[model samples]
Target: MRHTRRRLTWRGTAFLVGAFAAACTLVNVVPHGTILERPFVVEGPVGETLDLSYAELTVTEVRTADTLESSFEQAVAGGTFLVVDATWRATDGYIVFAGAEVIDAEGRSFWATSRGGCAKGTNSQPGYAWRATYCFDVPRDALAGATLRLARGTHGEDDAGQRRDAVAVVDLGIGQHDVNELWDATEKISIEMPGFASAPATDAGGEG
Candidate 1:
């Protein structure tokens, strides 16, 4: 009986030691294992140029709208539309500026409009400047402290770890007064296709 008790106590002690080692391993491994892979986001504001490796991007203007001109019928935004006019100058080879989104202060992201006279994406070659408009359908509250993000590759490609590229984050700079006015204002805006030095305000509208 004594021998049996000793054997059981030894087994219990061994099990306890194993459990303690496992707990220590979990405490050490969980933190490093759960570390998130954050994106390398570079920030800028409107009118400021960002050199995003493959291209140079400058957000010229940001407009809010309830209606869009070209697709006037189905182009109406549910909440409100955020239109961004940007100029791109490619530095390397022909670079395609595809990924775009508007990030709010609360870390909510809204993608650019795929409809209503807006270019789905823009591409430019070296030594040439191109202008395009990206429209995002966002809620009224998203207007305040919003930022426009542009990237060289698509979100999928970035996630696949295929390309480690630079992303341009431009602030919309919508103040409280501007937000109030934008929410109340109903305007029809036209988005232009990508072109060389094309003025978005006067450019011929394309069916988005």
Candidate 2:
């Protein structure tokens, strides 16, 4: 009887220790969330007349839900948006004679109308680029497949500003997870300058 009791006690202690170890391992390996606090570059083509150059973009406040409307609401309440703080370097094939605009998927629009020079101490060139922030409002009746777009335009004393558009869409179902999951999805989105030609390669690489 005494031997049996001792064996049971030892087995119980070992089982508890194994369970604790498993739980600790699981916590360490779990995917919690992502933070894009540093600036990153996203480059692609926009149209024939311009080579879109956009970098130093940051995103924050990601929320998820079963429906687009719900997720958008949460994102808005949490101040979710995209911020672009870089320059648009004109390529040899294109000339940036005007400013740019940001158009959303739902036809909402924002403008970036300034031609400034890049500071000497930064990883930017002495060219022209627009700086702005685009706030995506939670649609009142957004469907599950709702999406948002960011467009750049050339508008000044030049030809009627040509608009080059690029889009980034999010699935509402993916946003329904916890905040961490929503953030992960947002970070995975790729923002490119559609239709524009690629800029002359620059060796301006640094930690963001």
Candidate 3:
């Protein structure tokens, strides 16, 4: 009986030591408070000449009585549909340019590119907005679909003789209404913009 008790005590002590070691390891692996990362997604439009003055880019899921009819109406009205507009500023002494594309549930896709309008600037001041138009013509057949995704692409040459690529995703919905009314609805949507000065070093570290 005494031997059995000693054995049990040894096992218990070993288990406690292992647990304490594991806890220490976990604490070391865990990140501390306050992460300094740039926020993804900005709102507003890319004005004429690539000068973007976006309110904030956001994604919202909308359910409409008639998806086809509403999507059609919004496309016709122009600027009525919710769009994910992407913009960028140079960090780490690089100049970066960004663009976006829209993909439907059925695999249909459309993309927009910057074509000589806005110029790149420092992170503190994201100069003129570089604008590109990504318009999708929702087919009359797609009605009861799942969702739409907006994918962003960033391209530019950095100071270190390297090319960089960045991508982001957002989900949106097609509301049942005319495009004109949809544009007005955009006023209700809001988004959070990352502080230019507080962006990630990798995000702002490379030259473009």
Best by TM-score: 1
Superior candidate under TM-score, 1 versus 3: 1
Cα misplacement distance, residue 9 of candidate 3 (Å) = 66
RMSD of 3: 14.5
Candidate 1 per-residue lDDT, tens place, 1-208, comes to 3444455577889999999999999877774312443455678878877877677788888888888766343488898888888888788998777788888988787878778888657887776668888888989888888887788766553333214457877888987668889887799887666677644222243221
Candidate that scores best on lDDT: 1
- C-alpha displacement of 94 in model 2, angstroms? 9.4
Select the stronger candidate by lDDT from 1 and 3. 1
Candidate 1, overall lDDT? 0.75
Worst 10 residues of 3 by lDDT: 113-122
Q: Which ten residues in a row have the lowest lDDT in candidate 1?
A: 199-208
What TM-score, to 2 decimals, does candidate 3 have? 0.29
lDDT of 2 by residue, 1-208 (tens): 3544555577889999999999999877774332222112133322212233432211222232221222113222222233232333333333322333334435444343111211111222233332222233233223223332222333332212332322222222322233343333343122222122223222252221
Ranked candidates, highest lDDT first: 1, 3, 2
Q: CA lDDT, every prediction?
A: 0.75, 0.30, 0.32
- Off-target runs (Cα >4 Å) in candidate 2 are 1-82, 93-97, 113-159, 163-201, 204-208
What candidate 3 gets wrong by more than 4 Å, as runs, is: 1-92, 113-164, 175-208
Give the poorly placed runs of model 1, Cα more than 4 Å off: 1-38, 71-74, 156-163, 198-208
